[model samples]
Target: MLCIEVLVEEPSAEAALKSLLPKLLGSRARHKIINFGSKSKLLKVLGQRLAAYAARINKGENLRIIVLVDRDQDDCQDLKNKLEVIAVQAGLTTKSNPDAQGQFMVVNRIVIEELESWFIGDIQALRRSFSSLPSISPTSSPFRNPDNGGSWEALHRFLKKHGIYKSSYPKIEAARKIASQMNINENRSPSFQCFKAGIEALLSQENENLN
Candidate 1:
């Protein structure tokens, strides 16, 4: 199992992933994987970094492993399809499985941004605290007061609801708590029993796709 990582914004994200993913790698034998991405206003997002990342990964000497992606939309599947197209354009075979005779695990990205999904909660109510504050329009432009939906605000409600507000800050840090809950890497999280099964199903489907 080759391991590689890239970024989104905060360097702490990379630091956090380093701490998080290695433990998630489990018993797989680690192999060399290229790591690169830049953090800048116009360049931080994966949309801007795809070409550079694609170029780097195209030079693989062995079967490949994918670095993860963001949770902007339910588009991880779309990203995989795009990557397969890109790989085809580059004249390379894209292995679509994590465990196969030779296939490398090449697509591991998390897209669930809100923690409530795993917490068995609702969306409308989840963002109500921040969303109800005000309504800013496209007509407002830079003056359009954007609603704050930071983990800070989200966690406050979560802890308050769960009756954990009295404990400490840890009880209400939404992103931290979400990160703690989500594996991000596929190999972690004992709670994701179905997730593991889905990975197996994906591998099976990919094999059928190959055939």
Candidate 2:
């Protein structure tokens, strides 16, 4: 079995991915999501962790690592390149640098702005999670481009306008709720699709290896 180890930026992303991965990978694939509390913490230990994994892989461990983090103010490609560099420095090959059969050990994903962008991508899932939410078209402006600076605040205001969760945006709870209803087959967020595509490609490779 293929073991996909996911490194996420925070507990909310961990919660969200935990809820979504099973639906995406099915019962066959084994996966784990690890959170580092913040981006700084993640980058701090990432190199060492990847190095350890590289050693284990040399010992015949069937493992793959996927790193996910919010893009925030950083350049998306730059962040991805940085992660790939870290992986390479730890003696691991990335999708950007694959072996003879194009096999890569690490996949890095950047969530544009924030993970809230994904929630904004599938407003219908939010509506399903919170029935009181007003009907929202997928083409709505805020939903169309969720990379706004204050995405969480914007989402909070939008939900508050509908008279739901007026106090604050419960990050973990909201993530889990929305993820439960997320349509993995379709999402408007480019970042989310990139994440999904990475998982699918890994799964496809796993299947080929089994065959």
Candidate 3:
């Protein structure tokens, strides 16, 4: 079995992943989710942690690491390149450079705008979480690209306008609620699909090795 170490940006992301992974990985999956307080903290210590992980890998430990961070308003390619550079600097392999067999150690993904975009990706999940959430066409402007504004704030406004959550967005609570209802294999967010694809690749590689 492969051990997965997921490094996330915030408590809300951690909560969401905790709820989603079991469904994604099944009852027998082996993984650990670590929240790094904030994105700043994560970027600060990511290299050091990757170095430690690289050392463990050298000792024949079967491990895979995933770093998930919110893209916010940063340039996506630039962020990914920075992450890839850090991983390589720490002596770890990345998807950008693989061996002849195409093996890599770290998978990095950015949540477009914010993790709440994931909930927005699945309108049915939003409706399930908040009964009063209006059924807008998935093809509509708001639903088309949930990353339009501060994704979380956009979600807050949507819910507020629809007579659901009247106050502020409850980050952790909302994550747990909406994530539990998310269809593991059927989200429309490109970033979410990127995340799922990375995990699926790792799991597939692990299974192949087991055989």
lDDT of each: 0.38, 0.88, 0.88
lDDT of 1 by residue, 1-211 (tens): 3333333333334433443344454443243323343223322333434455456656752233343333334455675566555444443343453334554434443324322232222232223423432442323322121122233335455455545454554423443333343443432222233333434443454456457
Taking all chains together, the TM-score of candidate 1 against the true structure is 0.41
Clashes of each: 2, 0, 0
After superposition, candidate 3 runs with Cα above 4 Å error: none
**TM per candidate:** 0.41, 0.96, 0.95
lDDT of 2 by residue, 71-171 (tens): 98898789988998999999998777777889888888889889988988887798899998778876676886766556777888889888888888899
* Per-model RMSD to reference: 11.1, 1.2, 1.3
lDDT of 2 at 123: 75
Q: Please state the error at residue 121 of candidate 3 in Å.
A: 0.4
List the lowest-lDDT window of 10 residues for candidate 3: 141-150
Clashing pairs in 1: 66-106, 71-111
> Candidate 3: deviation at residue 1, Å?
1.9
TM-score of 3: 0.95
1 versus 2: better TM-score goes to: 2
Point out where model 1 deviates above 4 Å.
1-15, 30-63, 74-77, 90-92, 95-102, 108-110, 113-156, 160-211
